[model samples]
Target: IGASAILAENAAILSSGGGDTIDLGFDLNLESPINPATVTDVSEDAIEGLKVVLAASEEAAAAAEASMPQELVDHLDELSVVALKNATNLITTSDDEVDIPPKPEVVPTIATITAPQQEQQSPQTLNADEVSLAPVAFDVDLSESSVKEKTLDEQTPSVRKILKFAIPAIGVWLCGPILSLIDTSAVGVLSGTVQQAALNPAVAVTDYAALLIAFLYTGTTNMVASAQQTDRGTKDMPRTAKMMIGAMRMSTYVGAGLGAFLFVFARPLLRGIIGNDAIGPAVFAAALKYVRIRALGMPAAAVLGSTQAACLGMQDIKSPLYVLGAAAIINFLGDMLFVGHSNPLIGGTAGAAWATVISQYAALAFFIRWLSDKATKTTNEDQPGVINLSDAILEMTSKSDKKDCNGKNRRQSFRNVMDTFKGKALDAKRKRSTLFQNKGVVQNIRESSFGKAIRRRKETTTKSSTDDDDSFSTRGFLKNRFTTRDLFKLPDAETREKFAPYVLPVTSTQVGRVSGYVAMAHVVASSLGTVSMAAQQVIVSIFYCLCPIADSLSLTAQSFVPAIAEKESSMEKSAAMKKMLVNFLKAGAIFGGAMMAAVCGIPMITGFFTPDQAVKELVNSVVPLLLVFFGVHGFVCGTEGMLLGQKDLGFLGKMYAAFFAAVPYIMLGVKRKALAGCKSAGLSSVWTVFIGYQLARCGLWLGRAAKLQRGTYIAAKEQESAAASATTNMSALLAP
Candidate 1:
């Protein structure tokens, strides 16, 4: 459990790369402070570099520990331990190694220190002159090879790369809107306003369900991305495939159950939501039928969502685009074939719902095919064999070297890994210390502790008693760690615990957002009369059409931020995240600006949706608020993306919960205005409040991103932890 906690704690650092304060487990304010300012043997760069790395990244202290020089890292690592013991009382292990608490889960600024005692006295400050800490964490390697020699361009994600992922992801986000637009245009062009208004409530119900299921896929994406980071370029493909398969199964079951519920309660849900007064009995009847049909697609939507998330986690954006594109084609064609001008037993809207369901099922089939094929691929082609994830876990917690039934893994060489995950240092002088013992391979600090541990398993070789080297190297390691388990099994508790931090916070956010959308459609806009609702639908469709433009940055942040968490240095990780954010924001800004201009300059854009002049005028009236929505929408998404990328889920969840709770009350005002028939109480006013919430959201998330980039949160958390450790007078190592 401690080992798992270490992985979870560092995963964020490995991914976010920046933490504010890194408690080096040292207390500088002991009875007599030893002068750290002047050291005889170590160069100033060595000590300064240590300082830079340890001020550490966390709670809004946007920072990551940079991979550094081996001699210095080793020297300081020993000093850190020495400093640790001299400062605070600690227990010695049987072998005399100090137990370093899993590196303080470096959360960036403003995080509450879960220190058992809040009143614990804070650590006394060390003067900079006394400490000689370096100002810069970057370029601290002090190796003869200077910064100018290393090409940072290769490290940064290029515009082409960002667009490659962002474009497809934007398409993925735009898929629903695009599909709905096809239905709206077809139904409105043929069936008229009454039929078109029916789409308002029905689409709301379906979209909310789709939004609510975000936890399934979003959690999978972050989990897979974290695993990829843990592998640190070892390319553990099987682990990834196994996780995706499990997530897909979970999503499928959840989706199916949600679909069944909706199918069973479709009528009551619609009637209860919009009530009878909103659109007349005809519109309510059509909406109920549409929702029932749409409910059938939830199971399919679930599978596709997870598949898309897995692919995106791997940074394979185009695949999701292709699947969504195919779905769109089916949806467009199905709408034409199934929906018509004249009403049959069920209405035209119901026919469109059926088309949507068919498209969803088609996407599901493609997703299933993709998953099976993806699962079978080799993780490392160069390596002759693969190691399962379960094998990886066993080695981390294993303390004994036991032989399997076949008598493989009896070799003494594979030893360091057993103690490493427990925060034990690699024995540099051991006869077969595979970690950093290759004659001149002194780059110890270049790889994360976890990264080094993972590599030990990757290059493992097993030997048997009878034949010196005949035993299978990879197979031996697997057996030594634990018995082979079914590869298709779900991720165990430890793995899910890692994912919970990333998923739980966002779960509330999604639910609140879903509630807000549902309220907007039913409680807020429903009673505004048929022409008003029809015009609202027209505006809504345009909003969906331009969604790709607004959503591009958010998707880019989601795809790339966590993908590059394994960079050698905290500086590089921080720079990389910032670079991606800057580039993505620029793209979002440019596209969003273009969208606003197009809408304002081209009012005739409404002509495509309807022949009725009344609907066009109403749509035009809301153009001002729509512009604000588009202009601010992109930035909101981009900021949220950045925060989401940082896994600042707790913050986002609160904001979203507040917004969700506010939706009903705020919409009540809109409902009253609509009842009183205020001229401004139409779509424009309703959307104005939404735009305000989005703008507020954008400001808040951006502030968070700034704090994360600065790593203030990280520094504060460490200070709090250090203080608590000192105050509590805890005997055990500081809890991670």
Candidate 2:
């Protein structure tokens, strides 16, 4: 329901009279002319044509299993070809720059003309006049309705709520960066310039290694959000709670696998990334040590990332802030104590790595306990364990009066209550018995997927069937321990098949991005030696720490777009969404402008990172280029956020996959300069290349956003105009 729901009411389509109506009927092909949203001077023939079209559309829509979100995202192109855009004419209209006509008046026709209840029945038996009446334009209540009864306001969040989610998210983004910045500052001042230079390669390997599997975080969130909305809009299976469990289990295994892979091949991976002679011996050794040690925390980091993503998808933002805030403090204190002139074995970069590892595991422990507690509470409420099924049934029968309750009504009510209870339970036994063995694949790929949306019950936890059941609390929960068995259960056959579409493209995209970036950073930073490497590290560190500002805004967009677009609006939903988007864009632009001044101020504090004049000058020289990069990235992140929220992941995946092409070209350029012993290629040109890439992304996303935004605006204007003129056209339309 969070994504998209059924529009409950049918809209009245008032005509201006004349519409450039092409032939519209049961059969319309590419060459057939379609009616535009606005019409004037309509003849009876056009009305007849429209009636046919409206009937066809309504029939298709009612029979369509595709929710509005499913229509917008899962079957966009297919809808265009068949003109099912009218299937959701209640919301937004599709087709390039087109508006939709309102559904016409309903009229009775012959028995033979009446449509059958089958999925794809046609009104072929109707006569000409009956043909027009055959396709009824009015609302037809069907037993298996695809859309939700909720309005746009009900389906999409308001700006205030989005900001509520956004503000807390900024802190969540900052926690990881704060740890890195601390390490950079402590290592630069305490361990000296050599160790600082080593950080560029060390961080590239360690951070990106975690990000390489970041699909688990991003993909899980997208799928969960979609599933949640679907559950709200339809009567289908509830998948959100199921997915929550599956995602945690799947992410842990994947994280552990990645950790093992990195630990075993740390040297070769680092070597391949930086090239054979990318950094000097001492720097390489330090980076390798850091990478190997950080690899140990990969599983915890991955699980934490996935856990946080699941919460975000559920629109719970405060939990991450609470958890990460405590983790950040732990990391800060650990860094201060462990780094700078500590035990020789634990000093410098190694100490920083150790500090981060400890904090990550701490955060992980808290999250696990928190999840287990929720299960314990939910389980206790849903079922009091001391009352066995047979005992409960016997007790219920004993309580019933023989004439009224025990005869029939009591048993029927009991069955009904039992079914609802089983549907809502969270324990392993219920999951094993009920959650698996889903029905066959759906025609809509979106429908085939499994999800787990827990609609939390308000039932009192203190209430239980028997006195013995009250004591069943602590000991009952301990059987599962810190982690729920629900999270350990692997995906069954149906799950693996359906879950692939949601996760595979995202993982592929992350793989291309992480590998390409790690390779590109190695090439660019290593070309100019230790001085350049150190300068690059400082610049990157500054950018990433501030990057959360732009990132949080992007995340806000991602969280809102799909569900809003799927909702019915007179442009209000889209307009509200657009307004929210503009606010964030403005925030990004203002933040970017301020950071330009911040870059200039960086020269004043250059001594904090390194005392070396060469490193300082190189960093200062690139401030102008860095300003361009910061400004360009603001728009880049916002537009990409729009696309991400649009669920255009398939296109995004291919776009980034193509982006890997630029890495090889940039690599060759750096290699040529290094071989020729030319120090002329500076960080300035590197920043320019990155700026160009940012511009390319902004341009692409901007065009796509513009097209989609225009479609929605036109849809809104037409809806308002049609509604406003209803009185004007009502007489003319109903004229005998």
Candidate 3:
């Protein structure tokens, strides 16, 4: 019955033209009760309940009509009347079945939904044409989605781990460039562009010379670190020692030989490559002097390089840092004293060169001493010497016969202690002869204060000897030191043969890099003239100085990856490489951003280095291109480092060779363009070529690293499958 009433009301409301109000009523009684004692009583109660429900519904409808607007009330009343008439007609027409009309299709129209208006004499109505008919849409905020991405980045363990190594490595690597910058700054204060321009090419020559032997440093670090990882407990100390010795010998010989060659040919080489036109005759002369003086320190520099590499390989960076710090201080002092006032002893650029030479030799001496000390400490701990004095004292005090307080026994004990102190053995027959012959002397010795002190000291020494396994801890042991001979002993023929394969690849990689720089210098000098070449060098120097930060990050990867690879599964190694690449790319991007900022400020920076307007303008104009070059170059360096870590020397050598081979063509193009009278074919052209080179290097290295990673993963999976198959076959064979 309630369901029928609700349907009737809904139908009425739908049929109403507009503004119809809905009224719902309930006719539940709290006080009235219907008894179920008899069927007649239940019938009477049901009839009464129906009447009450009908009356209550009518009253609710009347109340609803009174509260509603006149139009809505009229429409509702008409709807109700129509519904009632239809019901009456249907009931009267058929006793068993009733015909009903089909319901109308109702469409809702929410009209005139205008914004609220203020009270006025004339109320405004919105026109249908003026109202919007289309559905409204809202814009979405994309920032909501990025929150999860940022959280994931923050939480990544691999990124954090990569940073742990990268940060420190970058810092250490930065020290070299920073020192170079200081040198440049000191040179910049000189009188003219001649001296300053000369510094650029001179430094380049010295750097190239250093690069020729840089393999010793890199090779030593990689091999030694790897060896240390494989032999963690010093079991392979002898082999490592031999390798160290061989590296030192190679460094010194190559360094000394190169130094002599450079010292002799400095003038001709500068004239041939840099040319008399590029560097003024006066500048060339000064540069020649600088190069010769600098050449004198090459042996020391090489030795220091090898020592540093060894220290780095052992993960003992502190020692190298200390040595370099001291060297830098010495160089600074020498610069101030010799170069500041143009001292008569050493003047101008030569003074600076002399300062560097002095510092290099000083550093070399310190490194040698430090290495020797390290070796001696290790050797001493390995083979501890016996403390004879303490042992003899302990032996004499422990003898039961010597415990007596008699004058003769005391004198004998004193004599035995003195013999031990003097590092001599006493025979029993000799002791008896001395004791009998010196009876009066024995009485005098027993009563002396020195004799009593000796007995007391012997008792303490004996007690200490019994308490400790090695009495040397309490009493000093003889110094069993390792000499330079032991520290730098040559490796056996087989060991050298094993390491020989690695030497060439490493050297070639460095040579390829040096060749690129040399080519760049040649291109710049030929096309742009000496002034432009000088400007190019200054800009290049700045870029190279900052680049090591990125290179350091790469070096970190190189140093860390191999060690990680040795211990981890192939999957982990792949992940490590990926993580390292991501870290390197991030570091490169950050460095690039900084360089871009520096590029923007290049005008100001150029002022500090050079007062010449043309040079400053040239540098500033190419700053943007240089920024791109540095950004891409950082990743190239990092990728190279990663490959280096994998010990992919052959691939690196080939890539470097390809780079060197391609550079000449680029230079040729620049030269042809310049000859064709193109205004744009100058420094910008050079930078374009450089940028292209950087891009090519980055792409090649990144692709190679990816390929290596994929290969490692595939190899790991194949090995795992093979292991599983072997295990299954063994299990089948073992079953009954």
Candidate 4:
């Protein structure tokens, strides 16, 4: 501030000076000479000293100027003028402030800095506050966020979800029959008429047998699935395992019994159905051979069927598909190698039977392996040890832990040696030792990989009272994994009482269903000749192939109905049922439309089954009837499924019995009117009877479903009314 004041006074003095002199002074010394130290005091003496120095310098300058001659003065004046002009030029040329240049319209590349260049150019001397103020650039990763969003979408159920279950189930169910169709076609192409015709009854017998045992499959599936849904929260896995084991053992016995019956009575059954007068001796012989050979596979078939049903109940259709696909391949290859060859190892018809038998066993093996794997994985927590029968016997016979050579407990040297060899080292006190006695040895064993597994198994088997929930001991493991000792053991009193109502209905329903098929087959074999039966088989196979669309939906309904009924409120349950019914009806329409399209191309399709023109024409005549049958059957199937889901088996059983009783009459009527005069009735009459049966079935189911729906609505209304009445009574009592 002091130096600034002095400079200001000096600048004021210079401004008062003459213009030319001011210029000359500026040229001589462009800066102020006053020192900051001298100006610091700002006293009177300092000011006076500054004035005296300035006066002296001015006097000296005047004396020197007077001494100068006129010529010298003129020359100096000229030089000064020139220097001023030159200074003006330099200012104009160098100073942008004096002469401003225009900025370029476009920015230059050199002026544009990238993020990397800006970082490089930025000063590194910034303080913490400065650094924090700096802007940062980063790339945001969106993949993880996007994946989470997609996962949430997948977790929500939609049409896509329904199709996911339906499509796989349809494929799994269709694969077996489709394979059989292929086998039939292959056999037809290779064998004579008798051999080909024999396939009809043979297949029918085997199919009938399979269907008869289907109760185990269907029953197991429903029970297990329902149990799973109920125990979803509590996870009572032991009870579920027992149900499966019991069902499986029961299926095995039933299958074995049926198989033995079929095996022993194969010829008699074939003779009874086809009869000697109706068909050639060769056909009957072939049919008998096929039935007998095929019967051997029935046990395996039963096991496979039961396992398949269990898998379906558990919503695990993929396993069955894999198993079936492998079996189909084996059967196809067997058919190619064994059939159509004279003097083949098993002959033509019998070869096909053997192929079926082998494939069935192979399927059973895969199913067993899958079941074992599933059990091992699921029962990981607190699993029990497998009951060691030998150990149990040993424990029962011996009074002490120690055992002698003669299976007696004795504290002896020889016994001790044997115990040590068995990994049970005795103590110096001559006392019996545990299996894991030596700490060092036990530690060593535990450290090994195999020992770790043993330890795990041991941990699973051993249980404490406090750890009951976690316990899955060997007792349960053995019971579930192996055939029960009492394979034919009846359910416990509690279980029998619980399942009694369901048993009769389920049994009756299954029996009635099989009876209808049996009656249809009997009618076809007895009334319609072999050719018509063969055509019927072909058409029926095609019908089944198409029917799965409806059947799969039905199965889906059966699988889910109980869950829906339990979880939803009355209104919500009603809505769900309506939605299910509408969806199934739509699916039926679609399936029926597809069948109609198939009917249009019956000639080409029937060609695959047979080359005979008469058979082809007969198949075509029945195509329209088949179409009607499928359409009506689809609705029946859907309603049946809903009823089954609702556990309305009693009504279904009664309806099936009524239908079964009327089936003979229906067939007889069709025969009397349509087939009485003709030598071969063709398959048209047969399909007509079937269509009538389906129509009646559809009507009964629809009526029952409507009645159930109406009853439910009425009950809900009554409940609401009662609740309202109770509220009114309470309000009246509280009035002041």
Candidate 5:
């Protein structure tokens, strides 16, 4: 929606008339042979010709009209007077200015009509005819439509789209495991002792900032998905994409500011988190030492993640998948090459942080490339004009760059005038010697085969042609090269209206929810026994890694369901929703079951890592319980993403709000009840918090789904009845 709105705004600017203005000299030199009657016919024929041509050649027609001889133009003005008189005579009106001749023509161009220029009022004010017809503004009734009409689709799901979306989502999820494996295998092999030491600190920093990144990145998904879900036609998609790029830039700035602030005040912050004990000091010192290294990645990570989210939102996950996949590989290699050993770029914990920083930048490049590919595919718009980060910063911030008045009235008018009389003069020149209009593959083939063929034939015949013809041809080539389709790459007006309300709120809300959840998670974790907090942290991280898949499903749901609903295809919407629900349920069930298996089965895998009995027991007991809750959470995670995608943030916000309120109580309950022995209580508290929160969230979402289902059913029934009526009407028409 955010992206779409921006595109819509761009389209509005285009609609406001962005192309260059062309001024045609309408010579008032009336020749003595000009008979008013004959002139009228010629002028009328020209006007009618222009109207007909305008159906296809708005620019050329406008140009032609603008350059008409004054004699003919005056004749045309008389025609307007005659038509106005005829209209007044036919229909009775109470107006006083009934039979006056209309205003004189102010032909701006004789070229094709572009989008109508903002008509200029004559400088003389309060002409009776003009005054009577002046527009008046009024307020629309604000009362809600009492008789609720079913939305176009009424909330159906599209399994095909969902599947298309899910495949990439799954692809994105695969990155996590790939990264973990790289960390476990390559990093370990490359520098075992250094890598092991790096692990705890790396985990700690990541954990601390994980929520921040998630919230930041969520902005991308909401904006991108909103852009996709709302049908803004093709032009708006890329414009919204550009706007999102701007927003991402804003987010990066903010993130960088925060990171810098954190780096500067790291000692104080660390002291607060860990206190004055020797372990606290060591942890704080280690964190402070490496924090800046890790923090450098914040802008890149946030921006890259947001870009990927946009890709997902646009229902183009392949780009992000490929980019991230490549990045993960690079990150793995970078970890091995730069973070350990005696190469001396970085060593120990600092080396690990440096590896993360390197990986982030590598990943960022991938995302930028993906965005570029999307832009190229979607529009004929130029590659981002300037790539210097500083230039982007200035462009985004500069007030002068914000408004585009030059592109609107001046340029469009200029184009219109040039295409008028001059257009016919150039018609033979403009006509392609070839038959087919160049588009994509056709254009490619034309370039490769047809161009060569045309050149060869031209060369064979050119023994009779002159250098003047070559120069004219060169001019034509230059004109065509510079003149891409005047389609203007403007977004649709309706698209902005459709998405403006839906997208930004959802994105902002998601950011709030994720950030809140992070803070809430920590708050709850902090109150639990320290061991439980540790257990909780690990479980949450694992959950986050797995959650993306389910979230992918939910995102698919959010995008697909409401879109179907918008079609007013109730039954289809219902079917789509049911399929999504079932898929998500199955996904949740699998995730839950798998988590349980992992948690319960961890002991079997732990022998390779360590032999500490306490660590083994704590991990094994927590894993199974954590997995079940994780599965439950997985279901809702996607559902939440879907809701956000749907731009249904009010419902989503309310649901998460309730869960947040309930989680701490659940934690307190486990803590107070002393459910587990002191040695293992921490792990149990973490387990209880997740299970309780997820279970509650699941119930809330289930209830919301049921209500939406009922609404969809009613809408579907109405649509079916309407469709049947339409069929009957069609039959009656046929009988007549």
Candidate 6:
């Protein structure tokens, strides 16, 4: 678990590389205090160069670590503790041979430390002047030659790219409510006869149930989105699809089981819940019937939702949009044909359900075809290979031997002779220490003290100093320390034959991307549910009608962020973020202002759609509030996209939950407490809370944006200054 945690952290840092270095404190027995000012050995250019390479290395290492089986990871954690102790002993001692230390028997607890206890045993601290420190940890070497540089402008995503993706996002968000509105319109136009009304009694409950089933797909979206952030593409998209399909199948069985129970006792349940209401029992029976049929579509709809999430994660929204648009049209026409311009009938409601069922199956078919093509492509890519432990040990031993040989050659060089021997003859030394004598000398040394010599070499090579040069060799060492190549190179089968047999399969995390269609549907449904599910649908449909424009702009925003993140180009990130925000806000403002104006100047603007006086009154009261929400809707959408990019779904979930819970409470309060409650207060208590909560959340999101922007600015400034300093230092070092 610790190893997994480390790998996750490393992945995040590498992906967000902006010239930061890993500050593992090894100088004090893995407890060294980080002194940023004191550590100045690396050149800014070299550090920055390493940042880019580290990004890939970190990703690879994370993949390798994630691939390890759970049991192996648990064992690895145990071995790592032993390794750390051995490493500490080697660093503290100065013998010429390697000595392995036993792992500590007792684990240290934070509460176990006291000031007096710590004071009794402390390493001498260098005050202001002393510099050198003993080696403490293994630093793998990765080749510096692997790093590459690219121009900010050339690599950054274009405005057009952002719009293309964002547009699809907007479409995904708006389509659900529009479809719902179409259903409502078609149903409302049907005959008002008593029998027809009875046939569609539980329209409200069944609609909510359908949406509840749809809500199950939100999890699919979040998972797929996270997968995409880590480079998992559409080829692996089906794994997510399959999982969702499984979940959907399970949900369908459950929904059907529940539906059956409800259908068997529909009359009694309806009476119990809505005792005095004349419409209750009939509605309950209709709801039970609707569920029995709709339950069959659940698994297919779930799979469709999963596929949509994966597509969205891949940033391909066009397919889902096309599929849903056609589905909506088909459903509308089906509704009209079954019970047009007259009383509702069982045939009409069933016809609508059947239309939806067919559409879901069609969408499922399309998703499967797309997934197959993606899988085929992924199968051909170069992927990580599995390695076992025995081979890894052999590789370590071989590398150590080569390193020892190189050290010997350097020590035997002319420069070393001049520094150590003065006028002593090299031939005399060779004669004094012959091959046979060397064997005798080597035999005298025990493994216990042998590690000291290795420690000396580590300290000499890794000690930080301001005057140090940036060498290709040093960069290579860093590369080897951090790269995926060093993750776990187990010994070959021949070597493993002598030790404990362990199995490890190389595999990355398999959390697949969410389906774009599912996510879109939820966003639309939830947004519509905000006001009153039905009214919410009507308003959202209107908003969706303007989606072509909103969607085009959103696509531009989505495409620009990934490149900006990769390049560590703050200026471009800021510019793109700002441009998207501004445009969205402007569009929202114009939209909200126009709608509000239309409501105020012409009250019938809302009344024309509904004859129910109460429904019209509710609409009149909430128009301004709804308009305001719409005006800022663009900003909300853009912010959500940003959140997606950051892989910060926890925050999104919290905010979403709060909004959902708060809105309904306010609406319910206002309806129950009419003029008397309002007369005591300046305005209706409900609307006040409603507007307040919306504005408050908007403020919170804005604050988040500001904090992120400030962080980006600071990072950019620091990197630039470091680069400048590196240039100056290098110029002086090369001066004759």
Which candidate leads the pack in TM-score?
A: 3
Report the lDDT tens digits of candidate 3 across residue range 1-736. 1222334445444544243644444442212232222112224354456546644555565456445544344444445445444322211124643322222111111111112211110112222222221111222233522433332332222444445545555545655555555566676665345566577678778877777777777777777667655544332355455555667767776688889999998877776567336446778877888889999988788877876666666555456667788888888787766665555337667777888889988987776666554232444232322122222222222332333323345324333332232121113223333444466686688669999899899986785564343211100110233344543444457546655766788777777777767777777777777568768877887777666656665655555556655543444445555665677677666655665676676677787767888888788878878777776765777677778878888998887777777876777788778868888888877877778877888898989978887877787677768878999999999999
- Candidate 5 contains a number of clashing pairs equal to 61
Cα displacement (Å) at residue 90, model 6 = 58
The worst-scoring run of ten residues by lDDT in candidate 6 lies at 504-513
Candidate 5, residue 332: how far the Cα is off, in Å = 2.1
Query: Which TM-score value belongs to model 2?
Result: 0.59
**Each prediction's Cα RMSD?**
19.7, 21.3, 40.0, 35.9, 19.6, 23.0
TM-score of candidate 6 versus the correct structure, residues matched by position? 0.46
Expressed as tens digits, the lDDT of each residue in 390-509 for candidate 1 is 222333233435554455442222222222322222221222223223524445443668767776765443212222322211111112222213222444665556556755577788
Once fitted onto the true fold, the runs of candidate 2 whose alpha carbons sit more than 4 angstroms away are 1-150, 153-164, 185-197, 230-239, 278-282, 336-348, 372-486, 492-498, 568-584, 674-680, 710-736
lDDT of 4 at 275: 34
Off by over 4 Å in 3: 1-158, 170-183, 187-193, 234-242, 276-279, 340-345, 374-495, 567-597
Winner by lDDT between candidate 5 and candidate 2 = 2
**What ranking of all candidate models by lDDT puts the best one first?**
1, 3, 2, 4, 5, 6
Q: Name the regions of candidate 6 deviating beyond 4 angstroms.
A: 1-171, 191-278, 336-348, 367-563, 566-604, 611-618, 657-668, 675-688, 718-736
lDDT of 5 at 119: 26
Off by over 4 Å in 5: 1-164, 171-210, 213-216, 229-240, 268-280, 341-345, 373-545, 565-583, 586-601, 665-682, 712-736
TM-score of each: 0.60, 0.59, 0.61, 0.60, 0.54, 0.46
lDDT against the true structure, each candidate? 0.60, 0.59, 0.60, 0.59, 0.49, 0.42
- The CA root-mean-square deviation of candidate 3, after full C-alpha superposition on the true structure, stands at 40.0
Tens digit per residue, CA lDDT, model 5, 542-655: 555555656566655544444444444456566655566666566556555654565565557655554555655666676656566666765676566555544566786565
- Model 6 per-residue lDDT tens digits across residues 1-736: 1112233334334333334555543221212333323333444465445445545554665566566543344445555544443332321123542322221112121122334433322111112122111223333222221111212333333344444355456566555555555555554556333323433323433333344343333333444343344433222333443333333343344345444554465555334323234454544454455445555665565555544544554455666676677667666766677645233334544545555556666665554444344223346544443333222222221222222233542212312222322223233333333433465454455233666677676765564231133211111111212222221233244323311111110000001011111222233232222234344334434434553344333333433344345335444555544554555455444434554554354356655655566555655666676566555545554554454444344555556555555555554454444433444322224445545665775677667766666676677677768878999999999999
